[model samples]
Target: MLKGLGESLQVTLRKLRGLPVVDREALEEVLKELERALLSADVKVELVQQMLENVRQRAFKEDIPPGVSRRDYVIKIIYDELTNLLGRRYHPLTLVKRQLTKIMLVGIQGSGKTTTLAKLARYYQKRGYKVAAIAGDTFRPGAYDQLRQLLEPIGVEVYGDPNEKKSTKVVKKGLKYFEKKKIDLLLIDTAGRHKEEKGLLKEMQQIAKIAQPDEIILVIDGTIGQQAYAQADAFNRTTPVGSIIVTKLDGSSKGGGAVSAVAATGAKIRFYGDGETIEDLEEFDPVRFVANLLGLGDLQGILQRIAEATSTEQQEELMEAFKRGRITLQHFKMQLESVAEAGTLRRILSKLPGVGKGGPFSGLPVDEMDDESVKVFLAILRAMTREELENPKIIKGTRIHRIARGSGTHPDLVRALLKQFNQTQAMLKRMRKMRKQRGVPGMGGIPGMQGPPF
Candidate 1:
């Protein structure tokens, strides 16, 4: 994750978080912080100034939505602006049926092109694409061996010529070799070259002519600070780059140098390699990226994750409980555990409409149930019998004592948990009535419990 920029944005958001009306002066203060954050992230000064001016103009021109507060609206504006700043969206690589797509990887020296090639290979390979890789980086000593080691174990066909010095000739031979097979995607990894390295740059250009790739992917090294922009520009100038991949982003918090780089290359960033592992590559989705960057926890992403991770039968059971307007100790525990499962509870709550600071559930005691406390509550839940869990009314006096003993906790602790559950149930009933007043649809499922730790 882009931690540095994320923290800066979050700090800016927090400054306006509870403010019902964000006046001109307050917004200016926040914008200054935002400008600093983006600039620090290696975003170009011109882009940063333009974004701030746009944000300022929009704040004055735009009206807050009917339900959303001014603060939330401002946050939305920032999110939209950030999304716009980051290429808007990545160009999704869609493999055509019964068609062989060729992709050429080119980048400056030590930009992690070879590893990215393997990651892309695995990414396509897992999706049932007949993927193959070509070791066109003949200048590198262990380029062929490295490509082979990465792809061979994964059952991806890797072609290379150790004897060949010319990258263009190697790529030509590789294309001829893979043409006989039913390969879907042929990835050609060209040797690393600098903007100053005319010979290597020429070799890359020559290879592009020889291979006539469907897409020329320019890989930018994320850790190179602001030099990423120059790197992308040089390659694109020599041979037009179709799409870009940013590598070595893991633990990178200082800046997103790719911002200026994308502007220079005029290419949509397709993928980002976040870690050393092949599985760490992800689509550079601006929406989710900005949403997560500001710690808003990507609401749609949360919904998608819940759909993927939870079963329909389980959802139905939870939905039934919500419909009855009575959740058992089990349902309560599920709500608590679900928050623990999805990152920090604060983030999940931030996405909810009027919940955390200036919302309806502002003082809902979220601090009481942290991760450790959730674990204890879950343990207490586990100690209860099926009937007691389903109908917590039975767990009084001796039953509470028994549960406490069984769960290795004090009897008062069990009582405290029971009391909190009662309080939460009452609050949820009030919320349901409010939802009805607001004409919101019946909310259910494990995802319905996607906010505020306990």
Candidate 2:
């Protein structure tokens, strides 16, 4: 999600970096590009305009935050503005002190409400809560069966009438059954209904009234783009929608529209569904999400993905290098190889905030950049003398030629690889600047591991 925005914004920021820091004219131009990008991604115009204005005001405020540089100040302002626009805090499921917590899921057809119900149950179960699912979606084909198929293995109790013709009756009965069971959390998956369908809306309202849910959540398909917000607005007006869960985000969904919907409906994002796995649901963290959207990598998610892809011994070595911030080309090659097994370079990079989509090589054809080229590059690097490896600038024409001969590659190819390394160094410098601006402390080192990889 947000691959396009991330890529575009990264390029735009890189271009802005060449100019004077926080200059009035340059700031204005950058803000304009940002506005265009957000709007193009289906973000609400009001939110876009408000965010740009905040960025402008903060940039021009003149007082830099303590211990920050001028360039860092501007980046910080932009980051702060984006975070504010996304909402300052994550809103998790807050249960009442005395009564059982009830949650109702509503959305248009194909919004994945049923699956979301099971996912929610699993999420709460992980938190040590006894949860039950009431399959209120009687109209949809196999709604009960599908939800049960997903939830039954987890030992979650489900209440539903698979053969019931009337959704309202099915929902009413299900709620009563769960209520008697004394479930700590009851999640009701209502039948998907269009905003224009008044009968369905009224039926939903009846269910809501009977169920008296503590939270009303609207499930939106992330692929719907700007329409997701409109759906949220419509549902919010019909019944109180406390929050939203955007599903199918692993696909091509920009998810910018969902941010717009947050602005429109004033609903917090409770969770985001990245994939079909029950564990794919994640709690919403505005700051981390904004960082991800702006090409500032999701550090936690990256670590988790790495853990999933690496074996115990390889993971130990990788973690050691990560902590030391001094990884060898050999280790880098291994990481690249492991990530390649699960996805394409473009796909993997797109998911990373600082590396893909909107950053330096936003529009570059990463898919064409193959693993073989990376392997070849590693081979060339391996041929370099120890002094050349430690101090790259020492490798002049003669050293380059020697390295090329040793690696059995063309001199021109060696030169090209060196040039690419220089480009990557420049990109890393820019990232260090951005990270400092965002107040991500201690990029220079990590805690657990010590020293560089050999």
Q: Estimate each model's TM-score.
A: 0.64, 0.61
Per-residue lDDT for 150-225 in model 2, tens only? 9999999788887887777877888778756767888888887664536546666777888887888878888777
- The reply for model 1, stretches above 4 Å from the true place, is 195-200, 237-241, 298-454
Evaluate all candidate structures by whole-model CA lDDT and list the values in order.
0.73, 0.67
Superposed by TM-score, candidate 1 places the C-alpha of residue 279 at a distance from the truth, in angstroms, of: 0.6
Candidate 1 C-alpha RMSD relative to the actual structure: 18.3
Candidate 1: residue pairs that collide = 41-255
Residue 216's lDDT in candidate 2: 83
Query: Which candidate wins on lDDT?
Result: 1
Per-residue lDDT of 388 in model 2:
73
